[model samples]
Target: MNYKKRVVKNNQMTNKTKNKFTTHNKNKKYEQE
Candidate 1:
């Protein structure tokens, strides 16, 4: 049960980072245009 909880936490962290990364890329694109 502890392992499963840890995996879920990690997944959330990765998702948050992925969102930040995507927004950063979008801002870069707008700057280039």
Candidate 2:
């Protein structure tokens, strides 16, 4: 059970990081345009 919770937490963090990375890339692309 504890391991499952850790996995869930890690997944949440990864999703947040992925979201941030995508937004950053999009902004950079717009700047280039």
Candidate 3:
């Protein structure tokens, strides 16, 4: 159970990072335009 909890936490962290990366890319494209 503890291991499963840890994996869930890691997944959440990665998801947050992915969202930030996508937003950053979008902003970069906007700036270029």
- CA lDDT of each candidate? 1.00, 1.00, 1.00
Question: Residues 1-33, candidate 1, lDDT per residue (tens digit)?
Answer: 999999999999999999999999999999999
Residue 32 error for model 2, in Å?
0.4
lDDT of 2 by residue, 1-33 (tens): 999999999999999999999999999999999
The count of backbone overlaps in candidate 3 is 0
Evaluated at residue 16, the lDDT of candidate 2 is 100
TM-score ranking from best candidate downward: 3, 1, 2
Query: Per-residue CA lDDT of candidate 3, range 1-33, in tens?
Result: 999999999999999999999999999999999
Between 1 and 2, whose TM-score is larger? 1
Give every collision pair in model 2: none
